[model samples]
Target: MAEINMRQAISDALWEEMERDEKVFIMGEEVGVWGGTYAVTKGFYDHFGAKRVKDTPIAEAAIVGAGIGAALVGLRPVAELMTINFAFVAMDHIVNEAPKLHTMFGGQMKVPLVIRTAGGGGRQLGATHSQTPDAIFAHFPGLKVVSPGTPADAKGLLKAAIRDDDPVLYIEHAAMYQVKGEVPTGDFTVPIGVSKVQREGSDVTIVSYCRGLQLSMLAAEQLAVEGISAEVVDLRSLRPLDMGPVIESFKKTNRAVVVEEGWPSYGVGAEVSTRLYEEAFDYADAPIKRVGQKEVPLPYNRELEQSALPQVADVIAAVKEVL
Candidate 1:
């Protein structure tokens, strides 16, 4: 096992995958020269050279379109959008074209493509760039959405997404690149669409993913001090969302608090809470509580931005409320 941050973990995953597979290549703005906007691919340009580590123009549509074309032609392309907000510029290609290609072509072609981008509102990037629209992408049937909380999952999931024949949108939390955790050595991949119980407890269940999972874990720590045992479930994959762990944890605890970085309405929290009610209505001890960002444009000021985003305190309070 090796201890590494999310940034290094992601970098290691990309480097190892490219080394192992000749067809795996990277294309994005500043990926080849600038070494990735987040520095996850910092040394890849020099190591992999221009042919494999490509630098594209600032057009997200072109990047995604070209990636789709490459994938259709039997190459695995990891396309990076500097930010998740830029993904909207290429929404039609992402949602309409890349996803529909396999089914539309009657399985004659495969899009082994991975769209990588970071999301969340902690960098003071303002409302436009700081939105968490993961749920929007997951709503579509064909695309697979994944957001990992720990460095281990980040590395494993990225490797898995690159190997999978389907197009996967792998979202990283902008603020979580520095967070460190232990990662396994050698070639291994975590299966996508599986939820893992991050912290096991008995009193209540805290459901979250990505940035929210970090907040939930911190909240669980605090809750423990108060003699409140809070079980935490990380929904690592959103689209092919595996609700098995969530349902099992909810059934055991009989109470839940769903936490997410996005707005509560029509957000991840809403989806999890609704599902819990649908599948485990009888197990509920109280109505499930949702803690999410304040429904407003994320402010440019750091203080306002932090206040608007869901916090550890919010998760703790929601857990207490649900209990």
Candidate 2:
């Protein structure tokens, strides 16, 4: 095992995968020469060379469209859209095209492509840049969506996405790049659409993913001090969501609080809370509570931005409400 930050873990995954497979290449704005906007691919250009590390125009459509073309022709391309907010420009390609290619072509073709993008509030990116619309992409069929909260899951799942035959939207939290955690060394993958019980407790269940997972863990520790046991479940993959762990945890706890950085309405929290009620209604002791960003455009002001986003206190309060 190795202790590393999300940026290092993600960088390791890309570097290792590219080294292992010649077909794997990265393309996006500032990816090659700029070492990626977030520096996840800091030294990839020098190591992989210009041929493999492509730096394309600012157009998101061209990036994703070109990626689909590359994938169809027997290449695995990790297409990076500077931000998830920019993905809308390439919506047709991502949701309408790449994902449906294999099925639309009667299984004769495969779009083995991964769209890498980051979303979340904080750092004062403002409303336009800080939207968390992960649920929108997850709603479309034939597309795999994954958001990892820990360094280990980020590394493992990214490798898995790069190697998958289907199109995948790999969502990362912009604010979590510096967060550190334990990651196993080399050559392992966490299967997609699987949920993991990150922390076990008997009193209540706190379900989340991405940045919310980090907040929930912190809230769990605080809850423990007050004699409240809160089990934390990380929904690593969203589209083919594996509710196994969440259901089991809810069965044991009989109460749940779903937390997410996205808005609550029709968001991850809404979908999760709905499924919990439908699948495990008999076991539920209280109405499942949801903790999410306030329904408003994220403000540019630092204090206002933090206020709109879900916090540890919000999660803790939701957990107590459900209990």
Candidate 3:
């Protein structure tokens, strides 16, 4: 195992997949020459060359549209939209077109395209630039969505996304780029539609992904001192969501809390809560709780921003409430 940050892990995955498959290539604004806006593909421009590592125009729609077209023709394209906020300009192509290709064409085609986009607040990027729109795309039927919470999961799931036969929206938290975790030295892939239980506890189950998962795990650690055993379930994949582990956890814990950086209403937490209600309602001993950002645009003030977002205190408080 090797300790790597999310940025390095993602870079390794892209490089490994591109090298392993001739059909795989990366395209986006500043991806080639600028080494990507976040520097995830820092050396890709030199190593992969201009043809494979393309630097396209500033148009997000054109980028995703071209990616969908390329995928239909047999190539595996990794298109980066810089930040997911920019994905709004290309939602027509992403939500309406790319995800519909395989089914609309009667299985005669597939969009083996991977859209790598960054999300989450905390960079002081403000309301417009800092938004978590993952649930929006996950609502669509034909797309796969995965937001890995650790370095290993990020590396593994990204490889899986690049090799998948369906369109995948791979969301990375802008704040998680520097977060580090152990990754296997050899090639490995974390399967999609699978959720992992981060810590085993008997009191309550907390379901979350991305930055939200990280915070939950932290809360669980602290909750241990108070004799409140909290189990943390990481929702690594969303659309092809794996609720088996969550259901099993809920059955064992008999209490639940759904956490997310996105707004609570109709967010990832809503979906998890609904699934638990439908599949494991009898197992839950208490009403399912949810923690997320306040239902307003994220503020620019540091103090207000921290309060608006779900914190470790919020998770602990919610757990106490349910108990």
Q: Of the pair 1 and 2, which is ahead by lDDT? A: 2
TM per model? Answer: 0.99, 0.99, 0.99
Score candidate 2 by TM-score against the native: 0.99
Better of 2 and 3 by lDDT: 2
Q: For residues 1-323, write the lDDT of model 3, one tens digit per residue.
A: 99999999999999999999989999999999999999999999999899999999999999999999999999999999999999999999888998888888798989999999999997877889889989998999988999999999999999999989999999999999999999999899999899999889999999999999999999999999989999999999998999999999999988999999999999998999999999988997889999999988988988888878889999899988888
lDDT of 2 by residue, 137-200 (tens): 9999999999999999999999999999999999999999999999998699999999999999
lDDT of 3 at 44: 95
lDDT of 1 by residue, 1-323 (tens): 99999999999999999999999999999998888888999999999899999999999999999999999999999999999999999999889988899999898889999999999898988989999999999989889999999999999999999999999999999989999999999989999999999999999999999999999999999999999999999999998989999999999999999989988889888899999899999999999999999989999999999999999988988887887
Q: For candidate 1, what's the RMSD?
A: 0.7
- Cα deviation at 214, candidate 3, in Å, is 0.6
TM-score of 1: 0.99
> For this target, which candidate reaches the highest lDDT against the unseen true structure?
2
Better of 2 and 3 by TM-score: 2
Give the clash count for model 1.
0
